[model samples]
Target: DPAEAVPAIAPTTVEEVNTRFVVLAELYEHDIQDFHALLEGHEAGDERYAERVDISARAVKERETA
Candidate 1:
């Protein structure tokens, strides 16, 4: 009876894992673009960057929920 275990095919190919990685990489690019845009029109050392940082932080938090 111990010899009747079902067999499963795990992702043993590089293509499969690479496809998943590509999708994640795309999401990361989009997030970074959004972050950069948030900081646009603001100068360095400006307090306005705090608002942008808060927005980016909230976005990251929301992404964690997803």
Candidate 2:
């Protein structure tokens, strides 16, 4: 059943699960901001589309490592 899909292992407590999500949210927070910055005044079909994508990817990596 769908209810049995979740693995029954460690981190079984609600607090533990919430802490994991909080850490992930903090890690990706800056990446999301950098992505939104790229959306301003940019279009998917533009000549610089690939370049913009590359730049955003690098920004996300940098933020994650910082």
- Top candidate when judged by lDDT against the true structure: 1
- Candidate 2 lDDT, tens digit per residue, 1-66? 987997786536888889989999987997888887787546655758888889999999999999
**Model 2 misplaced stretches (Cα beyond 4 Å):** 1-8, 41-66
Worst lDDT run of 10 residues, candidate 2, spans 39-48
Clashes of 1: 0
| Candidate 1 CA-lDDT value | 0.84
Model 1 per-residue lDDT tens digits across residues 1-66: 665786666756888889989999999999999888777645454667788999999999999999
Extract clashing residue pairs from model 1. none
**What are the candidates' C-alpha RMSDs?**
16.3, 17.6
